[model samples]
Target chain A: MSSTLIALAAVCAANPFRVAACAPTSTDIRRQAVAVATALSVAAVGLLAVLSEAILDWLNVSGSSSRIAAGAAVLVVGTRDLFIQPPSPEPALQGWRAGIVPMGFPVILTPALAILAISAGSERGAGTAVGMIGAAILVVAVIAVGNIRGTYWRTATVGSAGVVFGTLLLLNGVTAI
Target chain B: MSPVSTRVVRGVLAWILVLGVVALVVHPEGCGQPSSGEVNEAAVATVAWFGANINDDGTFVYRYDRAENRPLGGYNDVRHAGVLLSLYQAESAGIEGAAEIADRGLAYVDERLLNTPIGLVFGRGASARSGSVGLLVAALDERRWATGADDRDPLLLALGRTLTGVVNADGSVGASINTATGSTSGRSPFFTGEVLWALARLHLTFPDENFDEPALRVYRYLIEDRDRVESPWPPVSDHWGAYALETMSRWPNADDLQLEPDLELDGPATRQWLARQLGLFGLQVRYESQRQGGITRLTRGTVALPAGVGTLGEGIGNYLRFLDRFEVTDIDVDALNERTNCVAHLLTNRQVSAAQAQQYAEPLRVQGAWFRNDITQMDDQQHALSALLLLEDWMPQ
Candidate 1:
């Protein structure tokens, strides 16, 4: 099982992109966006798995080396999360749809997530479990950010989880090398 | 010039001077070079030591702590067969006492030989492993070629035949076998390679038509389904694969072997591929050297383990064989040779001295063995000895 995949999944689940895109929406609109975003996230995981070998061959890199690089990227994201404060929510942009453009196209289905998905796909059981967990986290984060009793505690929890994921990827990368 | 500009120039000059001094100190002339006769002398000493150190029942004393100078572990057939292969190679090269040492190693393997309905196998009960049998077959072939003896001809051929079962119809080889049930246990890239080499050698040594198809099957499996079978994917410079390819390329009427187009490296292609893989190891050492102080010593107070170094040596040595045998021209053989020389020098430096010999109660002393602080394993000597033997053949005397 790849720690890198789980770490990347954690990163994707806690990403600012989704929060930034959906933060301005109404309660009903946000719920619809989360559902659409979750579907995109799961689809991206499957697509990455199918195309991983071809992508690696095109890049002329081995799976192990790619995992190491992905692990490094995850570490960078985690470190950034640890030090920086979260951005304040903005009013919804004119002509912006909730799911298809920002949330589905780029926020949930990112290039970094694509790389992690492919690498993780090699480990079948682990990848499935993590991908499901990642989708669940996205849904929960969307619903809980405003409605939850302690939003500060939610932010702290996300930050702590990010640190743990980063550390695991970093250690696994070192061991693989 | 202004005072600031003058100071900047002085600072630039100072930095260059410091960098130059560091470079010179880090890589001195002949720093990792072994003496001309050093490797051969060590090889001979190693061959002699193994002969003297084997127990009467034929298994070797497995591990040694050079600092304590004492034997430290239980014996096993896999390492025992590896020692046999080294001894056979040394003897084939006319190294004195190598034949006698090889004979002792052969005795150890012979004791473990099993006669199955399919063919001759090595090891007993659940401990019987196909990889061990493959190594024995290789050793016997070398012994026969060196001495021109055919007394064990039938047994040798049969042992080679037994390996057919080790490989599945799909070409994946079970590394170990339960001789009692004739069932395979575990699959690995390493075992697949060892059996491939043995099968190829069996055909080359005897020119039997029967061995060809089996050899081809293993080769196909290795090249095609490597990712599926390789435990750790992106298989690194697998030396056994290098050896197997070299053997197949050099076989009589090699073009007639009817290899798959994708698998067909011909002579030059196989040679270049092996050399390229070996070159990566040199690159690894260079990367390590820039980050760590030297190749011989690992950082954090740990010395380089000879087994690891020797494994690299063996890979380099085999790569050299391809260069020599195929008369390969495209690759930079000299640079690769230097990489091997660096490893040899490290192994030679790490060998225990005569003055240090008395500390160990063992009669053989710690001679011809490489150590990491205190401990050395048998494969360390077997591989290091083989690498030195290759170096002797490689260098112009």
Candidate 2:
């Protein structure tokens, strides 16, 4: 179960949220989708590697303390995923601009993901985190290109990932004790 | 197995694995409990730090910044006497060279000890404070007890007598005095505890019936009257009073020490006072232990100063000793153990090795000294060394 959760969370974390946000209408904009996701993933992981420590220091929060807070947030998100039903699809985003719209901002680079990036980077160090994020993005790009999941399976996979991430977060926080 | 059952089992197993890994990593075997040998090593190292750091004149080095390798100047008489007292404790604990180190300190004190109309006192003129005199007297009393040499040092005995002279009829010791002129420095908050502790030891060592009336007077004022609460001195938790209570509890005639039937000496009342001090100055630490695996926070408090924390340890230790001798059952031993362990761990962690100190100026390279936040001071080493040495007994066997 732990192994399965780790795999699923990786996939879910790497999933190009733009693909879901753009949906049926923006499927033809494949080049833009791949380009934007790859670029954003690189930039996000890079920023996390470089700035998280300084930011946390500026906030007067120890790395260990922030790790605890991050774990709690991840736990809440994971618990939510386990219980909540996915909402029905929103209206399909129209035109090439959809790559940058709700998909790029909220779906792809969420607050949780941003937090996860910083904490993971802190725990794993910059080089490992960058590789992990890059690999996650590559896997996400392949999945987005394949566009091969039914809604139920996608939801289940994402939810399973949440469980794994939340458990990991909880574990990280507990170790800090 | 059914699919759900299999999945649940796997999940539980994974969680257990993570938890186990965390526990193993964060708290390896023998993490909290230092071996008796390690305590000795650390104690020896601390004594070595003291030995390496004292000036030729016998005054301990006041402060040194390890990173910059610089000496920071400042000194306090009470802390100097406190360090002297701790050295005697170290010698009794069988730390090598502690007696020599203490002798050097005594020599320094000898220079400061002056003949006054009242009695033998430390420091010059207006600067000679009762607390310093009390600590020096107490150190002398401890040394006398350990050696069991009946021929007393006249200066030490005189200091004891002089300390008794300062205890007012109501039990408060005057804060400071012009040893030359007998001028008063007025009453201070902490003097009662210092004076009480010294007088209690004075009585303990000499068995002087004359010392009892004044000792009891101070005890009544400190315990029954709660004089600090009424006086301008803030009602701060007094570790000195706690020490005195512990001393009075073990005196040969323990029952006779208590003047009033209802006056609490070293029981719940003493615990309450010590607990308050442990609460105020104690630090609550939350740190990551990789072995625990999950996001966890442990809020455990331990007293954290060199002087106050060390004094508190002795105070609480005496309380614990009192409880065990009387076979008192109501007190919480677990809480005492936790506090003991926390302080022990803290003292160990804060210790600055001689090798570590060698990075500083030639004079500052006194290994085995303890410091906090890169700043080392004489009192810091004195208190922590005393606390750690006392911990040999307070910690579980």
Per-model C-alpha RMSD: 14.4, 15.0
| DockQ category of candidate 2 | incorrect
Top TM-score model: 1
Candidate 2, superposed: residue stretches over 4 Å from native: A1-177, B1-31, B149-152, B227-235, B264-305, B354-366
What docking tier does model 1 reach? Answer: incorrect
Per-residue C-alpha lDDT of model 2 across residues B1-397, encoded as one tens digit per residue: 7543443354356345433433322231112555556666777887887887778888887887776777888888888888888888888888868877877887788778777777778876555899999888878877776655444467677888888778877776788877667655577677888888888887777785467678888887876565445554334546677667768877888855455554555445444544444333221222211112233323222223455546545655555566665544544354356555655655565566555655666534556765555667888777667767767775555
Model 2 superposed RMSD (Cα): 15.0
Measured over the true interface residues after superposition, the C-alpha RMSD of each candidate is: 16.1, 13.6
**Candidate 1 residue pairs in clash (backbone atoms < 3 Å):** none
- Return the top candidate by lDDT: 1
Clashes of 2: 20
Model 2 interface DockQ = 0.02
Worst 10 residues of 2 chain A by lDDT: A1-10
